[model samples]
Target: MRHVIGREEADFVFIQETKSKELSDARCFVIWGDNNVGWIHNKGDEGSGSLLSMWPKDVFEYESHVMGTGYIAVYGQHLKTSYRCVVVNVYSSCSLRGKKTLWEDISKVRQSSHVLAWCICGDFNAVRSSNERKGITDRGEQKSEVNGFNSFIDSNFLLDLPLVGKKFTWFKPDGTAKSRIDRVLVTEDWLLLWPKSKQYVLRREVSDHCALVVKSVEKDWGPKPCRTIDAWLLERGFNRMVKDK
Candidate 1:
């Protein structure tokens, strides 16, 4: 995970299925290196799921909104561009009802966020079309699930961000089955801010799911700018502003 983040030069990262109950600050440092990160995590019990969202504090200021075994939403703004957004990371369950609940939960988060711009990305654990899966015939139940997933996306007004790479994001260990169950979705408001941004599915490593990255095409015309720090929040007025919100 550390290698992928560093190589991609990502400002934000969302991870699912961490499968750990707790992660210390030191572990966060090791993963993010010198990025000055702030994070929100949902710790799961042994043999279950966990979710994590981390970003460089210098680049973005974030507040956690919702934390679930399958998802985490962070509302933040890019310090340099001052572009506001709410980013959600998801890792859904295999159970049909669980997947439906996951969709509804994310919809709630989107509706509640003050930020108009939204970006959701992660392993959905479900597909939107028959073409997304291989080595298994699409049964009636599977078709129904696809329709439900598509309806959720449509109702939320999200556009599926195109990925550059192999079609399948996940594969069985024996290579007998594959599916494009991982993806990124963004709202029209977000697309307006970064119309040229693109998402990619990197080659899979140890995990069955492939590594993903989203790169915004917003250009920097000048030198790099300054960053924010925890000290700034210590100011009398700034502290109050945070609390009042």
Candidate 2:
């Protein structure tokens, strides 16, 4: 967990399925590596699910937050970019009926906060297509669920950002089932704010689901640009071009 965060240099992080009713600042500090983070948490109910959304105070100005049954929406200003936006961290229900309510809840928030750009991200617990799931036990109810999830995205005008690291965000321990249920969906306004934004599916070390990091591609995550002398100045063609100019 720490490795992934460090590697990404994440400004914000959203985690679901915390399964803890109470979280201490000390614990959070350990996970976040400092006290400079501000966070909103929704404790897990019994064995259901929990949510935690964290952002560096230096990078994001904390405003207000809204929390529902399965999600937490944090509204703030991204200091680096000076853009105000809302980030919704979600952990959905396994059943379709429960999931519908979750979707509606988020949609209501979106409608209410229509002016603010939105980044809706987390484990959706649903998929948009058959291709996204494999080796599933429940095929009978899959198609309807797919349609419902898709409809939610379409109705809310959210764009599903392309994933970079992995095709599937989850895999059964025995390698039986695989699905791309976790994702980052953003409003068009949000896309305009961070045009190079994409979600990276990173290593799944301790959890069954892979850690997701959504960031703008400032540059390709590769080796630093190599320093070079002005070798082109030595070329005869370059001298000719300079002379012609």
Candidate 3:
């Protein structure tokens, strides 16, 4: 985690499913090694499903607004721009019914706050499209679940940030199944602060899920280059498809 943060030069970070009981201020500083940082950590049920959101105090002064079962809401003011915003870090339940209830709870938070500059990001454990999932699995993403997730986004008036670097965010241990279950969603007001922002699904490491980072691009990185996996080359007509392209 420390290496990723340093390599990415992240100013803020949200970690879900921490699977830890307590995170003291000293431990938080060790994660970032910055004394000027402020963080809010929500302990999970006995070392499982925890959450932590940290940011540079100089960049954004954050105040904890609410602490849900699997989420944390924070109201922050960007010291540089004086822009106030709300950030919700959620690690929703695997059950569809539980997720729906989580969405409803978030909607209420949105209603209570005057700030429309909101950003929600986490492991939703749900997908918006069938294309987001790959391989055989019994974790059937029901239609009602999809509709409820979409409705929550639409009704709340939030926009899903486009993902880059990878198609899937989580994969099975044996690498058979995969799904884009984690993401970052922000309101129009938040987009106004960073219209050129892009979300990148970083490669997975020890965890089953991938790490996501969203940032504004000040310089063009050029178009993404095409590359094919070695496994695909063994498939019949794979060479022909590449030649045709």
Candidate 4:
């Protein structure tokens, strides 16, 4: 995560796998920037779920929404994604049957009244394209799964940003190549607002799946030229003219 931050020169970062509630000290380990905000799930006895944490406190207006078992939404704001936006940190269920319920839950969030932009990202655990997979043994199930995910995105009009460096984010530790599962999906409003937004796959240090970082292209404010006038002459003439008038 720190590697990408330094390389990409990002101001605000959203991390999904902190795996802890106390992020006050962890933020320092991730990057040099100050003002961090952490939102973590309540780790119950089950010991299965994910969380969202971020830095540069000014970026996000912190809020929480509990969708279901492991799914949660940690709301944040930024110029990217939409003119008015809320970023969702999602950790979806691994089981295909469970994904059906997860999709419905996500759709409900989309249909909600004030949702201007919905940016969902995390380890989705489902592949969208046949080209995304490797050494495919079971095409039927895989095709069905991809179709389901595509239907979800199409029905919602979510835009999947083009991945930068690495093509595959997750791989079997046993030296088996597999599908690209981890992804970042944005809405039309987000793409329209920041067309240059992108996702990059980072090297895996902790888990089999690599981490993803999404960046919105910042609008450049062109260079400004300094202007100067004779301060003494301007003051004398301006005061005299004003007095006479």
Clashes of each: 0, 0, 0, 1
Ranking of candidates on lDDT, top first: 2, 3, 1, 4
How far in Å is the alpha carbon of 169 misplaced in model 2? 0.7
Output the lDDT of residue 9, model 1: 63
For candidate 2, lDDT tens digit of each residue in 1-245?
21112124677787788777888888888878999989888986863588888878888898999998889888888887898988888888888898999999999988988465888888899999899998987658898899999999999999998779889999899889999988889899988988888888887888888888877766667988866469977877987887898
Model number with the top lDDT: 2
- Residue lDDT tens for model 4, 1-245: 22122124553344545555444455554543443544445342244564543434444455555546445554555523224565665666768877777788888877773756667777677888888878657746777788899999898888898899788887778757766877888887767766778887878886787878777667668998866466745675776875698
Q: What is the lDDT, from 0 to 100, of the residue 144 in candidate 2? A: 87
What is the clash tally of candidate 3? 0
**Global CA lDDT computed for model 3:** 0.80
User: Model 1: per-residue lDDT, tens digit, 1-245?
Assistant: 21122113677788787776788778888877853888877885562778877888877877546776588788778777798888887888888888999898888878766788888888888899888999976555797789989999999999998778889989988999999988888899988987876777888888988888887655658987877798997787997886798
How do the candidates rank by TM-score, highest first?
2, 3, 1, 4
List where candidate 4 sits over 4 angstroms from the true fold. 1-35, 42-45, 79-83, 218-245
Better of 2 and 3 by TM-score: 2
Assess each prediction's global lDDT (C-alpha) against the native: 0.79, 0.83, 0.80, 0.64
How well does candidate 2 score on lDDT at residue 46? 66
Residue 118, candidate 1: how far off, in angstroms? 0.5
RMSD of each: 16.0, 5.0, 9.9, 10.9
User: How many clashing residue pairs, candidate 4?
Assistant: 1
* Residue 140 error, candidate 3, Å: 5.5
Q: What TM-score would each prediction reach against the true structure?
A: 0.83, 0.85, 0.84, 0.73
Using TM-score as the measure, which candidate wins?
2
